[model samples]
Target: MSLRVEGLCVARGEAVVVRGVSFSVPLGEVTVLLGPNGAGKTSLLEALSGILPIQAGRLELCGREMSRASRVVRARAGLSHVQQGRVVFPTLSVEENLRVGARDGLEEAFRLFPELEKRRHTPAGQLSGGEQQMVVLARAILSRPQVLLVDEMSLGLAPLVVKRLLPVLKGLAEGGVGVLLVEQFARLALSLGHQALVMNQGRLVYSGPASALLRQPELLQWAYLGRSA
Candidate 1:
């Protein structure tokens, strides 16, 4: 496994947003995290990436314990998080944004996102939503992380645009990176995932093969309602 979590818990101020979550993101696979709104999906990703402090439980990256590690430490230890919003330096060019992650990875980033190469000199703010997302993803990829945590990469984008991006994530998994994806489009995400996990109200209600969940809609519905099938 590239990333492992055991009984992980996280609190937002006084309220606990994530409760006793445990899972493993194996290398060379995409693990889709599905849940309803306010189900703590984003919180779990934040905790895993060190954006939020882990109140309890263990976090291991490539077999190294890092529960108490800072965000910088986690990033350096081969973890990269492409957050919900397409965060990029508005005035910076696509090539410049990628270089911020790793100067040597510019060509590799351009190769993965040829569209970005065409606009290499264009400022990020001028790109469309889909293009901006590509820049964010490319920046994360430039880091060459062992585990990638992405939250809502499809937010506010057209379905066709989302479809185009999904394959890239799968390709990353095929190339030995463990991808933990938190997405609202359950069906779309499951179609590309090797494993599926369903969360409800800060707790995991389902964990199994992605194909299994895809085949059984009732099971997924039950999980969304915080009940066992």
Candidate 2:
């Protein structure tokens, strides 16, 4: 199974943000979406998650066409999205918030995030930013999604925390989940990714193996910094 996008276009009323974007994220692999700010990475993710209408093209999750599906339907069909920022329910306890969409995997969530297990009864709003991010991750993991979309997950977190979180995403990919990660830390994302996709000016500038990009930093420099590769 895989998440397939073809000739995708996204708009925010009157203005187009993503234009004719296309890619494939097969199961058991990580596809890193890298770009500078305002490069339309987030807009692409939003369109895939059904949060924004697809202005054109097609989206298929696990072989099911889902261009017109609602966000909740897509989620139920094994597409999970963890958007930027702490989206946990502030008034709810950590465990309560986790239980909202979880059909199972409660223990697995706790196992991946022991910190949350220890503070399961605590209000989600009281946790630190990193801890809250973990809560969101744990909840998403518990859903056992076929396609997981994570946007800016490591943003505003400590380096160590970012390090810890990335491995978990890798583990998920290893377990047969298609993970599409949008991140600003280009090197770190490439390190964990099986495939690297770079966007610039709302278009895909590069799409290839992660190792190739890592071995030749010039390619990244050309895509991101406009230097010769």
Candidate 3:
């Protein structure tokens, strides 16, 4: 049930962005990817989601190879990705946008973010940033993914809101949903992660217990503050 990546290399045109990265995400655990900006965290996630082709690499999502597969195949196999920018359709009602994400029905999504039930008829564009985030997260969960890739889960939110989301993520992890939480907040990211990896220049520089990351002030300052994380 884990997402295993081996010798992953991603590129755009002639420029290599992620170079030979490798890691394993055990089932139900929260494995976080941390790095400064331009560390290729998002790019790596995109490749796993099958939204971007892996120029060179091997990815097994819940035991199925995804590098050469379609995005739909990846979706059906419990690999869900919630991108940084909310991608809800503006023209669609909140419920409609959610319905699009639901593989089975809307109830799964509603259960995750009950507020959406109240805003079911409203257009997604009218919602606040926090609300929009809920929509994206709930929608991803609607598919009943075993593995979830969350990009910047704390971005553009108040500290209180971020605090609230952390518990939900922890609950998910406890329930056996493997999560790859890509974030810029070093302190917060390490706290939620059972394990963490730091990436730089398209390569992984560190892979160990998340607790180890909290102890290194120099690494934390360099990883987050160095490049606008």
Candidate 4:
């Protein structure tokens, strides 16, 4: 496993948003996390990335324990997180954004996102939503993380643009990077995933093969509705 999270718990002030969640992201595979809004998916990713402290859990990356590691420490340990909202340096050019973390890997990033290569010199703020997302993803890839946690990569983008981005994640998984993806579009995400984990009311309602969950709409509906399956 590239990333192992066991009995994870996260609290927001007095409220506990994530409760006893556990799952693993294996190398060369995509683990799709599905749920409705306010399901603690973002909080879980934040905890794993060390942006938010975990209340209780065991986090292991590439066989090393990093439960209490700082965000920079986690990043250096081959963990990268592409957060929601397409965060980027608005004034920076696409190529400049890719160069923020590491000087190398520019070629690889451009290769992975050829559309970016065309606008490498353009400021990120001037690009479209999908292009900005591509820039964020490209920056994360430049870090060469062993495990990548992406939250809502398709947010606010058209279905056509989302279709273009989803395959890139699958390709990364095939290249031996463990990818944990939290997506709103369940069906599209499941099609490219090997494992599936469904969340509801801050807890996991289902965990199994992606294909298994894909074939059973009732189970997913139950999970989304916060009903046990």
Report residue 157 deviation for candidate 2 (angstroms).
Answer: 0.6
Error of 4 at 21 (Å): 0.8
Give the alpha carbon lDDT tens digit for every residue of 75-98 in model 1: 999999999999999999988888
Q: How many residue pairs clash in each candidate?
A: 0, 0, 0, 0
**Model 3: residue 197 alpha-carbon error in angstroms:** 0.9
Where is model 3 more than 4 Å wrong at Cα? 103-108, 221-229
Candidate 3 C-alpha lDDT tens digits along 21-135 = 9999987788989887898999899988887789887999877887898888888888899999877888789888877877466876667777778898999999978778888
**Model 3 whole-model lDDT (C-alpha atoms):** 0.83
Instruction: Give each model a TM-score.
Output: 0.98, 0.96, 0.90, 0.98
Looking at model 1, residue 45 earns an lDDT score of 94
Worst 10 residues of 4 by lDDT: 220-229
Which regions of candidate 2 deviate over 4 angstroms? 225-229
In candidate 3, where is summed lDDT lowest over 10 consecutive residues? Answer: 220-229
- Candidate 1 ranges with C-alpha deviation above 4 Å: none
Candidate 4 regions with alpha-carbon error over 4 angstroms: none
Worst lDDT 10-window in candidate 1: 103-112
Cα lDDT tens digits, model 4, 1-229, are 6799999999999999999999899999999999999999999999999999999989999899999999999999999999999998999999898899689989898898899999999999999999999999989988998999999999999999999999999999999999999998899999999999989989999899999878988889988899866
For 1-229, candidate 2 gives per-residue lDDT tens digits of 7999999999988989898998999999999998778889999999999899999999998889999999989998999999999699999999898998585777888899898899999999999999999999998888879989999998899878888899999999999999999987778889999999988878888899988899998898788763323
